[model samples]
Target chain A: MIIRMAFTEFKLYLREPASVAATLGLPLLIVVSFGLLINPGTDTSSLVTYFPGMAIAFSLAILSLNLLPTILANYREKGILRRLSTTPVPPASLLLAQVAVSFAVALAMTLIVVVVGHFVIGFTVPAQLGGFLLAFVLGTLSLFTVGLVIAAIAPSGRAATGIGMLVFFLNMFAGGVFTPRETLPDFLNRIGDFLPLGATLTAMRDAWSGSFPQPLHLLVMATITVVFGLAAAGLFRWE
Target chain B: MAIIEVTNLHKRYRDHVAVHDVSLTVQRGEIFGILGPNGAGKTTTVECVEGLRAPDGGTVRVLGKDPRADRTHLRTKIGVQLQESQLPDRLRVGEALQLYSTFYPDPADWRRLLSDWGLEAKRDTPFGKLSGGQKQRLFIALALIGNPEIAVLDELTTGLDPQARRDTWQLVEEIRERGVTVLLVTHFMAEAERLCDRIAVIDAGRVVAVDTPSGLVSRVDAEQTVRFRPSAPLAEHLLTDLPEVSSVRRVGGQLVVSGTGNLLHAVTSVLARHQVVAADLRVEQADLDDAFVALTGRKLEESK
Candidate 1:
């Protein structure tokens, strides 16, 4: 029943063109933009080479920070959630449906980025294919879990969107989107590496370098997923 | 047997009491109307029974199960349409019906429901694109989609034109004819009088009167208000001399003769005897509106 509800929610989410564009189209557009600006052999290279890294990062961010919150907030604002409380549908089903929708979006984002990066940007994905896939999936879970927290706690739909933007920008900057964390100050590097975004970024960077994470990074990412997921579940309100 | 039993339901919001010691029983296969003015706690009482809101002090049993305690079972058997309910703006009418239908095990045929509610043309249209009457029709369609044993509708015809309102009223009758118990919450006196088998008039969070519509109306201290416009404003004694005239009051160049049956005939007889000509002579029958006003000491529109 829960899975059926989740599938129903995903179908509804996919019907919205704006949700589709934001989750699936925006990341591909970013990759195309990078493809235009970058020359692979140049010393002053563009961020096109970082497409695969940004793929996992962007997918996680969009699912957790962008898509899930808006959907949940809209449900709350329109009294859909309130009505559901009177029905047989479990409250957890709503949260699970949200995660399922984002996960589906992540799959689409990953495929787009991989195809675009390989052909247009002339970038080679990690040589350790198995290791990279494992790291990418774990990183997606971490980011998606963070979005669950936002969806649970946001007071309104507008507030959820605002907070999603704020969290996305902050995490993107500090999680080594522009520059690698190694070149930063030692304290900042230490803090960034432990953060959920920072940890996912490290996993993605390692995957891009054709090496698996040293187990501790994956552990930290897993811990972030569990902690935020629990917090979101505990604080969630059907009304 | 009663399909729904609400006993002394007391709901308070902050310092104000919303439903105060209100109790009513609705039997199966009957249309029971809950009529009240705005701010009269009609919605609160119904929502409590539907398990949407918990009553501070009361017991609500739908199908012999406590509403708040046995919510899942209660929900399966009961259907509800809230007063200010809203669906997603981009949700299509058919989609809303389908989504709600999924919650119930045995739902009505979607095509038949759309045609019954006159929403077939707007099935593919988004909810926000619908006109007010169309939206209301869609709501009614969604409410009946679930093949519920008991359905509660709050302000069913509010915001609808006269024609649309009559259509909805007829739909309510059709629903009852299918053996589904209905609890209609409304403020319109004529609607209650026309559609309800019995009515419970609420005021100030209390059940003021509960009976058949005409029973309550006849019980109130109301007399027929006989109104007539005379060509010449003279001798108030003309109407006052009538045998059945209770009181004569001049309201804006019109003589209002308040009395019981034969008051009109007596007034006309008196006027004819004196050869007085009256224009636009009219007799206003005492109805639920007058009873409501007389019982509450305030008009329905003025209560809130």
Candidate 2:
């Protein structure tokens, strides 16, 4: 039942052209546009990780912070969840379906970025495969949990979009998506290390450079996932 | 047999009471109505019966199971169309019905429901693109997709045009013909009169009356008036003398006679005896609207 619901949700998500463009197209555009200029194949600098990290961060932020919250809150605002409660199937199944759809979209985009970056853009694949997988899983979980919390508290669809945009921009600026941490002041980088997006980008970059992620970055993402996941579950309203 | 029984149901939100006390039983294979103006707690009452809400006090049983306690089980038996609930804008009509059909153990065929509800042509049309009447038909279709024994439809035609409203009413009758008990909620007097087998008139969070359409009108004072232009001058005492006629007066060239119990028949008979031709005759009888006013001391539309 949940699989059927998730498939339906995925179909609905595809109908929204603007959402598809923002989540999928925008990230690929970032990677290709920057990859052409940086010519990361010949360059030996740490700057090779910069473009791919920014693309991943942007895609994850849009999917988890922007799209996930808006869709869930809109379901609540429009009474779709309320209608589902009257059926034999519980409304929580719809929530799970939504999460499944978002995760599927995120996973698809991640693979596209990695494959295209390695083959087309001439960047090396992450050598520390275990570290890369761990960082990616923890980062996705934490970011999606934050989005769930936003959906739980937002009163309406428009409100969810507003709150999500605010959080997305804040994360982008503070988490080193806008500028590399190498260029930022020491205090900002210190603060960025604790943010979910920041911890994710740093850990992912380390794994791409053939090193295990710092324990501090992994701990920060894990803590956010647990705390925000519990908060969202507790606060969600079906109607 | 009663398919649904809600007894002394009480529900409140914060300091304001939404449903103070509501009690009604819906017999199987009948179209029962909960008619009331806006904010009269009509939706709140049906919500309890639908198992969407847990009443603050009292018991609600549907198919012999407590609504709140046995919600998961009762949900398969009772289908609901909420007042303001909506589907996703991009969800296609066929997909919505097909997806909902999976929720039930014994589901109605989605393809048949598509044709049955006149939505076959709109199979691929997104919900946002459908017209109001089309949207209402889709909602009704979704409500019955589970093959529930009881279908609870709330405010099914509040925003429809007269023609569309009548069309929807016919569809509701079709539902009853299939042996599914219907619980209809609306504020439209004509809708209740035409569609409901029994109606419970709710006012100010309480049920003012519950009876058949004609029974509600008869519960009123049963006063009727007959108006006509007298071809020949007739004595006012002629109408006043009849037991059924309580008062007689003149409006321009017409004489108006008001009374109770066969007042129109008594007035016309008296006119025939006097050999006076009654020109432009019109009889006004109390209807559901009038009964609503008499019971609640306020007009239905005015309460809105």
Candidate 3:
């Protein structure tokens, strides 16, 4: 049932150019802008070095904070969820559809960013494929779960948009999208490791730089994903 | 067996009681009308029966299954059309029918439904782009897609013009002709009179009266009014001496005389005696509207 709903949702999602632009186009724009701004002449190739972190933040922001809310908002505004409530469709199928679509979008966005950053912008791929894949899967789960929570609670599309923007911006900054956490203030650095966004970003960066993070970072992200996922399922409203 | 049996159903929102101990039975192959104004709990009660809402108290059985407890089974057998429910803006007319049809084991033929609803040209058009009447027709088509034993339609023709409204009414009759029970919710007395085999008149979340449309109309003892456009304005003195005349009032260059049986004959005789040759004389018989007004003590619009 989830697969069937996801297939239909994916088709519906493709028909909306605006959604495609937000999910795919925005991330590409961010990658290009950052790549140009960070002069290659710099000692560490500043922008290229940040590609892995950028990928994590972009996918998380787009999938969890942007795509999830918009879809859920549309469902509420159109009364699609309310109508579905009267059908034999299991209520959980809605949440599964949301997570599946977001996961697919995130995976696609990751591949696009990787291909463009490496082939077009002359960035290098992570040395360890196994580590990168592990980090990517964990980061995807973390973003997907948070997105589910936001969609579960938002009252309307407009409200969801507003809330999604706020969370996405905050996460982008705190999750080490532009600058590494080692450069942040001491107090923020202390709590940052525990933040879902921060933990996922740190893990992704380590995988990209070819150095693995402490296993605890991956565990923290996984635990948060599980807890938040359950909460979202419980709080979800068809209407 | 009755498709739906709603007994002592009550739903309250905050401190306001939206549905107050309302009860009704919709039998097989019958069109049952729930007539009430906005916020009169017509939508709420129907929603409860469709398993879209859970009533605060009392039991609702749709096809002998509890709506809230056995919702999955009940939903497969019942179809619901809320006034405000809509599909995604991107969904096409044909896609909407196909998607809904998948929910039931035995769905009606999709092509026939589209042609019957005059939606063949609009099949590829997005749902958001359809006109008001077109959208309404698509909704009715979707509701019947499952070949449901019972279909619930809320405010079936609230926004259509007279012609479109009549078209929808004809379609509804066709559904009944196919042996499907229909639960129609509306505020329009004319619609109830025209379509319902029996109607339950609801006011302020409770069933105030239930009967055949004419049976309810007869409850008020409403007079059959005779209206005429006099060559000259009717004099108030002409109606003063007639005992059979209940009330006489001049409204907009015409005289409206309201009275009991044989009032038209008596009115004509009185007018002729007074040398009145009215240009346009029309009888305004008591209708379901009169019954609604009498039972509720308020017009539908006023209550809303």
Best by lDDT: 2
Tens digits of lDDT, candidate 1, B1-304: 9999999999999999999989999989999999999989999999898888889997988899988889877777787776766776777888778767777778788788888878888888888889877877787677777778988899988988899899788888988988889999999988999999999999989998889998988887667787778876668876776678889998898888898867878888888877778888888887888888878888887776
The TM-score of candidate 1 is: 0.88
lDDT of 3 by residue, A37-120 (tens): 664334363335565467546666777787787778768777888777777776567767867877887788878887887676
Model 2: per-residue Cα lDDT over A129-210, one tens digit each: 8998899999999999999999999999999999999999888888999999889899988989988999999999999888
Interface RMSD of each: 2.1, 0.7, 1.5
Per DockQ, the best of the predicted structures is 2
TM-score of each: 0.88, 0.99, 0.89
User: Where does candidate 2 clash, by residue pair?
Assistant: none
Candidate 2 C-alpha lDDT tens digits along B50-149? 8888899989989999988998888888888999889999999999999999999999999999999999999999999998899999999999998989
Work out candidate 1's RMSD over C-alphas. 3.4
Ordering by TM-score = 2, 3, 1
lDDT of 3 by residue, B1-304 (tens): 7778999999998999999989998889999999998888999999899887789999998888898889877777887787888888888898788777776678888788999889999999998899878988998888888778888899989879999899889989988998889999998878899999999999988999999998998898877788888875567767745766888887888888888878888877877887878778999887887788899898876777
**Of candidates 3 and 2, the better by DockQ:** 2
Candidates 1 and 2, the one with greater TM-score: 2
